[model samples]
Each structure stands twice: as C-alpha cells, then as structure tokens.
Target chain A: MSFITGKNLSCIRGMKYVYGKVDFTVDAGEILVVVGKNGCGKTSLLKTIAGFLKPSSGQITISCADDLQSLDIIHYIGTSSSLKKQLTVRENLTFWSKMLDSDADNIDKAIKSFGLDEMSNSQISYLSSGQIKRCSLARLLLAERKIWILDEPETALDNDSLNRFIDIVTNHVKNNGIAIIASHRPDIWPDNKKLLEIG
Target chain B: MGAFLAILMRDLRSDLRNRAQFVMIPVFYILAVILFPLGIGPETGTLSLIAPGILVVSSLFASLLALEKLFSSDISDGSFESIILCPVPISVIMAGKITAHWILTGLPLALITPFLAIMLGLSFEIALFSSLIILLITIILSLIGAMIASLVINTGKGSVLLALLSFPLFIPVLIFAAGAIDLAIIGGIGNSIAPILFLCSLTSIALPVVPIICAAIIKWQVR
Candidate 1:
C-alpha cells in the first residue's frame, strides 16, 4: 500500500506565509479533502505537495512499494484545462498518452469513462467548459499514477458531470488510488476521507 | 524520444490547424525584405551590398514574431504544467518545442532567403550558400528565443520583454551570419567558411544548452 504523509507542513509565498503547521496523512484508497475560506492557501498547499512549490518548513513524503520518485507517482491537475483548443479531444488525449508512455488502450477507456466518447473527434475549442474539464481529467487515467493532486476540479462541471466525476474518483480510490482534492464542496466526496482545513 | 516527438507533432498539428498564424511569419519576412529594396531605391549594387544585413535582420524580426507565444500559450492554458509533470525530462520537452518553433518560423525564413537573396542581385551559388548559413543562424535564434520566452513567461508585455531580453543574445549570431553571407557575396565562398563554421559551432552549443535553461526557467516560473 502507498500513502502520503505531511508533517507540520508550512508554506510561504513571497514574504508572507501561506499556511502553517498543517499535518495530514492519506493512504491508498482514501481521499484528503482540503477545505477553507477564500485566500486560505488551499491551492498553495496542494501545489506544495505536488512539487510545484517549495515548503518553507516541514516535509511531505510519499511511501510506496514501487521505486518511482514522488514526482513520478503524482498527477497534479490545476484549475486550467490544459487542452489544446485546436486539436480534437482524441488528439489531445493521444498526445498525453504518448508523452506519458501510457498504455494506448487507456485512452479509449478514459474517453468512455469520462463520457467523452460522443465528442471524441471534436476540437477542444468547440467543447463546453465542463467537457474540456472532463478531457483534462481523462488524463489521470491515461497514466497509472498513484496520487491525484486536484485543485477545484469541479469548478465548471455541471451537476451530471460532477456526479460522474465523483464516481470516477470513487472508482479510482476503490482501485487503490490516492486522491488529494482541494474543493470548497467537500460534502460531495464520500465519508471516510480525511479533512484538512487551512487558511 | 516518444515524448519529444509527441510534443513536436502536437505543436505542428496545432499550427497546421491554425494556418493564419502559421503563414504570418513568412509573410512578414517577405514584406519586411520587400520594404528594404523599395526604400533603398532598388539600385543593384546597393541592394547586393545590403542584402546580407537585410535578410538577417528581417529574419531576426520575423522569428521574433512567433517567439513571444512560444511558451506563454502553454503556460496560460496549463498545458505546460501538465507537460512538465510528465515522466520525461523537461529538456526533451523543451527541445521538441524549440524544434517546432524553428520549423514554423525559422525554417520558413531560411527556406525563403535564397529567393530573396537572388532578387537582391546575388548569384545563385551565393544565394544557395547564404540560405544554409541563414538556416544555422535561425536554429540558434530559436534556441535563444525559447530560453528567453520561458524566462519572461509570467511578465507583462511579454512579447516586448522577450524581444528586449533576446536581442542582445541574438546579435552575435546575427553578426556572424550576415558577415558570412556578405563575405560570400563579396569575396566568394572560401572567404565565408570561417564565419559559417563559427555559426555552426554556436548552433551546436546552443542546441543542447538552451533547452535545459528553458526547462529550469519554466520550473521556476510555475513555482
């Protein structure tokens, strides 16, 4: 089993401290929902664990059976869709598949699971914001990374898409994936998740 | 290798789909070159004398047109964050991007140079040789531009800032490339070989180093 542990995690942005003395642990098949008010450094905390930002103090470590480094196992998805508007949905996913050296079969699986099969050939520019978000999330399945560092992944998603997303994350956890989600609506996630509140 | 090629093809395909932006650089290059001859009175001797400088300077500006968005689009759209987090080395990704930029902006500038040179009254042999030198210089420009583009990705007026930061880096290459072509036109191919070799050496050095610098800068920007 794999797990992530953050001990007294404090982050600083510029001269100001973002969040201080935050501690949390998330094992395989569990979700860590980070919640707080606006400007609570929720994004900064997630980015810190995702390796995008340096922690001013404390340490965050990932322990897994595999020999892969912490970066190799983490899949960090920020607020932006990160898809090319000029390319079709399939084209974007295919590019990620090759870039990550993932199994080609996962592309079709991801498209189907994310309900993107119907618009698979449509350019990203033509898709709705919710649809674009789905395309970006489909990337998580394109590779078998163990940790999912998601920041407000439900922002533009509609109700049906949101339900679908929760299902996907549930399924991912069921399959032994770790999801560290930063969301304002933590109720959407199932119970049995650790809540870390920061501001 | 797979990641590099994937990024390259993805960029190429994206540029192909947006043909307007793809065509703008070469069109800009041609227009810039055409203006020089018109303003200089079309005197063959004057045109020939200034052709090397004209081609190099225009190509430099034309190449700059695309460098502004080289990494900014990716950064703004979030593709860069995703790409950087991938298992492949960031240098590989940067190489792919630089190659794509060169193909879209630099390669066209180099390819069309010979015709522009001949139009400015240089011999076919000299034009052919000058195009090769221009090609090498364009490669180096793309490398330098990619590095600077990544550095200024988060700054306001990035295009202007990019040009400012990259111009000094580009000047040395510009001097050598134009000097080689001028030498070729004035004293024949043999006299231009030294500067040509110098351009080649510059490209070889920049090819491996620029990408690493770009990767590091990009990482820093996101941080």
Candidate 2:
C-alpha cells in the first residue's frame, strides 16, 4: 500500500483556481520532486498533502496502522520557515522536541547531526540567512514522521549547506521515509529522484 | 491537562522573556491613577470620589494593551498552527492562553490598585475591597477581551477592532467594579459585595464559553 495518496485534489484561493484530476502516491523509500513556475500552487499542493489545507473536492488517504484521527504523520516545512525570531536556537529545538515527544537520546543526536550545538544559544533573529534555513530544516531532521513536505527548502542556503541538506533528504528517504520537495532548483536532487511537474 | 499546562508555561515564559513590555503595563496603570489627582486637583473628597473609576479603567486599559499579543504572536509564529494540529481541543489551548494573559496583565494591575488607592486618598477597607473587586472583574474582562482580540486576529488594525468589539462588553464589568467600590465608600459594603459577586458569576460563565466561540471564529478565519 502507498504511504500517502491523494485522489482528484482540487483547491481554490480567492478567485484563483488550482485543481486538476490529479492522482499521486508516495511509497516508503523514494524522493518526489515537485517542480513548477511561480503561481502553480506548489505550496498549496504540499499543504493539502500535509493535511494543513483541505482540498475543495478530493480525498486524501494516509496509510498507517494508526486510526485516521491519529494520522497527522506528515511534517511540513513551508516557505516561511516558521521559526520564532525571539527564541534562541536551543530553545526553538527544545520546543519542537517537546512537541514531538522525542526522547533525549534522539534530541541530542538531532542537535549534533544538524551541527546546531555551537550556535544553540544565539537567537534566530541573529542568525545568518543560511543559519535560519538550517534551523528551520532541523525540524524536518528531528521529526520521526514518515512523510516530509518541504517547500523551497533551498532558498537562502550556501552551496555547502544546500549539499548538506540534500544529504539529509537522501538519508531520510534511505530510512524508508517519503519526501515531497517543491522547488525551482532542479540541480539539488539526485539523478534518480522522481520528478512531478505541476503547472 | 498536559496540553493546557504546556500552553500556560509557554505563554508565561514568553511573557517573562519580554520583561520591559510586561512590566510597563502595571507601571502605566499606577502612573495613570497618579495622574488623575494631578488633573482633577487633589481635593480629598474629589480624589476619593473618582479613585474607584480610575482604578477600574486603568486596569482595563492595561489589560487591553497586552490582549492583542495574546494569540497573534502565537498565530504568526506558527505556534498556533502546531497547537491546532495537536490532539487537544483548540478551546483548551485558547483557555490556557487567555488565562496566562490575565495572570500577566490583569492580575498585576489588580494587585497594584491598593497602592494607587492609598495615593488617591481611599480608606483602608475601601482600598482592599476595591482591589478584590477589580481583580475579579479584570479576570473576566481579560478573558472577554482575549476572545474579542482572537476574533479580530486577521482583521486590519486588530487592536482598534478589539477595542471596538470589547468596549461594549466591558461596560457591565466596569459598572459593577466601580459601583461596588462606590457603594463601599458610602458605607454600603453589604450592598456592594452582591454586585461584585454577580460580576464574578458573569465571568465564570464567560470564561469557559467565550474562548470556545473565539476559537471557532479563528478556525474559520484560517480556513
């Protein structure tokens, strides 16, 4: 069975329409890249799949042993990064750690893995743009969700950080996790990555 | 219970982190009360006559100042989104946030009213009793104000909209709070306590119900 599936998804914001009789599925160990131009509802599609936005006329089926009510198993990293500027890096990680209910072992590993230890005390507002992006991406790294929906995760990072981010995405997919990345940058993904174009 | 406690702790921590903004509310409350005597001349009878109204209005305004930030910051930072996605009810989260807001703003203003009363020439009993009444009324009014602020979270100029939405709702609370003190000063403490008790009752009913309504409105707005 597919880990995540959306059938006949349709969405409309204001008067602008965004819909098609689209059928899509993501399995356990594959990366799907969604490429489109500026106004192609890429973020909307990711939001719909992540259960943040309700499609006007469609059904989303997320397969898991848990009941439907407990199936919010997707972690979303939208364009805004959504990190509070007032909070220090460690405080921000601690907040998400508590939210995810991850044990200390996993949280420590995530902090180390993200190379966030040295800058942990710095407020997010003080971080460089690349650091801010890394701080936001750290949630995707730490969360145990089976599905990851990342929107424009490569926007403000240097080449080194972008390569490191690709490594993290590849590692997540290697662990039987599904990823849906929406970006205009095609060179970020590996050659074997599945491409889905939406206009 | 865990979710409620988490929200309360988070909000309290956030409020404490912004010490200057939080501290200024009570400071302003006290300063506003002190200024009243300067404006109207410090005649003992006149100061005594207006002290209760001054205390209640100042407390109301101080509480309102912090109300706008109650949910907007959380909503803008995506904290509200995470909370909404939690298994817990949004109403519970809203209640926790509103309760924390009251503890920070309303409670401080109420606690400082006794000091303001002494400066304004109120008797000891009148000062203490008036503080108690203001505390009760401020708790309720803060919750109602939070509800109004949450409803207008997405609206343009939310603070003004919150005031426009809440001032009418605040009339009854202001009336009972000031009236109870007035009655006490005139030697009708027995008559005053009943209105204060009624105000408390209104708050008790509003405390649980208004947040739920406001949460519903917020859900609709986000959708």
Candidate 3:
C-alpha cells in the first residue's frame, strides 16, 4: 500500500496557477523524485500532500507506520529555510525536535551527521547559505514522522554536501521511511528512485 | 500540555535573545510619558491629570509593537507549518504564543507603570492603583491585538492594519483604566476597584476565546 496517495489535486494562487488535477502515490521504503521546471506546482504539490496547503479540490490520504488518519502522517520541508535566524543552530534543532515529538538524544547525532557541530553555537543568520540549508535539513532528519516531503532540498548546497544529502535520503528510505523530493537536479537521483515529472 | 510549554519557552527565549526589541518597548513608554511634561509644562496638577491616559496608551502601543513579530516570522520560515502539524490542537498553540507575548511586553510595561506614574506626579496610592489596573487591561489588549495580528498576517502593511483593527476594541479598556486612576487620585479606591475588576473579567473571557478565533483565521489564511 502507498504511504501517501492524492487524487485529482489542484491548487491555485491568485492569477498564477500551480496545480491541475495531479495524481500521485508514494510507497514506504522508496524514494520518489518530482522533477519539474520552475513554477510547475512541484512545491505546491509537496505542500498539499504534506498538509500545509489544502487542495482546492480532491482527496489526499497519508498512511503512517501506525495507522491511517486523514492527512496527518507526513513532515514537510519547504524551499525556504525554516531555521529561526535569531536562534543558534542547536536552539533551532531543539525547537523543531520538540515540535516533531522526537527523542532529544538523537538531536546531537543529527547535528553531527549533518556536519554542523562546529557551527552549532552560531546563530543561523551568521551561517552561510549551505550551512543554513543544512540546519533546515537537520530539522527534517530529526523529525520522527515516517513520510518526508522535501521541496528543492538540493538548492544552495556544494557538490560534497549534495552527496551527503543524498546519503541521508538513501538511509531514510532504507529504514522503511518514504521521501518525495521536488528537485530538477538529475545527479542526485538514485538508480532505483521513481521519477514523477511535471511540466 | 508539553507542547504548550515548549512553544511558550521557545518564544520567551527568542524574545530574550532579541533584547533590543524587548528593551525598546519600555523605553518608548517612558519617553512618551516624559514628552507630556515637555509639552504641557511640568506642573503636578497637569501631569496628574493626564497620567492614567498616557500610561494606558503607552502600554497599548508597546504591546502592539511586538504583535506583528508574533506569528509573521514563524509563518514565513515554515515553523508555523510544523506547529500546525503537531498533534496538539491549534488553539492551544495560539494561546501559548499570546501568553508569551503578554508576559514579555504587557507584563513588563504593567510592572513599570508605578515608577512611571511617580514621575508624572501621581500620588503614591493613585500610582499603585493605576499600575494594577493597567496590568489587567494590558493583558486583555494584548490578546485582542494578537488575534488581530494573526488575522492580518497576510495583508499588506500588517502592523498598521493590526493597530487600526484593534484600536477600536481597546477603547473600552483605555476608558476604564484611565477612569480608575482618576477615581484613585480623588480618594475613591472603592469606586475604582470595581471597574478594574470588571476589566480583568473581560480579559479572562477574551484570553481563551480570542486565540481560538485567531487560530481559525490563520487556518483560513493558510488554506
């Protein structure tokens, strides 16, 4: 059974439209790449599936490890860096860790895994573009939710960091977690990952 | 219960870390009160005449200054999305943020009003009474301001819109707060306490209801 399923989903923002009756499903223990040009509703689709944006019309169901309960089964990381600039890297992680109801012990591990130990005390505003993105990715990693909806997670990262990000995604999928990444970069795509392209 | 405490602590920590904004509210309050002496001559009678109104109005602006930052940053950075996704209800989350805002802005301004009143030539009894009344009214105004702030989060020039939207709701509190001080100055503590108590009751009712309304508006805006 699919971890996330959406039927006839559509979203409109003012005069500029993003979605049009899009249908997709993501299964557990699998990676799904959503490839599309700029302004192709890729981000909106991720948001709708993650329960951030309500669909103008259609049905979305997310199944978690425990059970199915409407659409409350996913953690969404949007294109914007969600880290509070005024907060240190550690503080930002702690805030989200608590919000996601995750184990506090894993926060340190997640920071180290993201290569953010040295910058842990640094406020997010002082971090470089890549560091800020890492902070946001760390929050996503720290969340206990099973389904991940990441929008353009590859933007503003160096080649090495991109490889590290892909590794994180692979590990998450290997652990029976599902991820739907909206990106245009082909190099990050794994061999077994399914591609859903939107024009 | 845990989620509420977590949000409140997080917000308070953020507010303290950004000390400049927190410090500016009281500084503005003091400065605004000081200006009355400059404009109307520093006579004890004249300063006492306007002290209560000045105190309440200054407290109102101080609370309003921090209202926009309450939810806008969270909304923009996607932290608000994470919050809404929590298993705890949205009303609880909204209440947490509003309560934190009151403690940081409204509570401080309320505490300092007695010192401010002395400077403005109020008698000791009148000063203490005015401070207590302002504290009660400020909490209510802060909650109402928060509700309006959440409603106008997506609007153009949200802070200005919030002030305009909430100012009318604040008029009654202003009237009662100032009236109570006026009564205290004339040795009518008994008369003043009733109005102040009534204002506090109004605040208690608004505390729970306003956040629920604000949460609904936020949900609608997100949709």
Best by TM-score: 1
TM-score of chain A of each: 0.94, 0.91, 0.90
Candidate 2 stretches greater than 4 Å from native: A19-21, A65-70
lDDT tens per residue, model 2, B1-223: 6667766777787678788978989988888888888899989888998888999888888888877887787667666555454456778778878888888888887788787898889988788888888889878887788778878888768989988889999998888888889988887678687787889799879978987987786666555
Kept native contacts, fraction for each prediction: 0.81, 0.10, 0.53
lDDT of 2 by residue, A1-199 (tens): 7877778888888787986566788888888888889988888888777666788888878877344334456677777655667678877777666566555466566666667788988888789988888887887655587788898999998888788889888888998988999989976798767787887
Tens digit of lDDT per residue, candidate 1, span A56-161?
Answer: 9998777753332226788889988888999999999999899788999999999998999999999999999889999999999999988899999998889998
lDDT of 3: 0.82
* DockQ winner: 1
How well is each residue in B134-159 modelled by candidate 3, as lDDT tens digits? 78877898788888888899887998
Tens digits of per-residue lDDT for model 3, A2-84? 76787888888787678787888878888889888888899888877766677788877765434322345577778778777
Off by over 4 Å in 1: A65-70
Best first by DockQ, ranked: 1, 3, 2
Query: For residues B60-81, could you state the per-residue lDDT of candidate 1 as single tens digits?
Result: 9998999987888799888877
Candidate 1 is graded, for docking, as: medium
Ranking by lDDT: 1, 3, 2
Q: What DockQ does candidate 1 have relative to the true complex?
A: 0.76
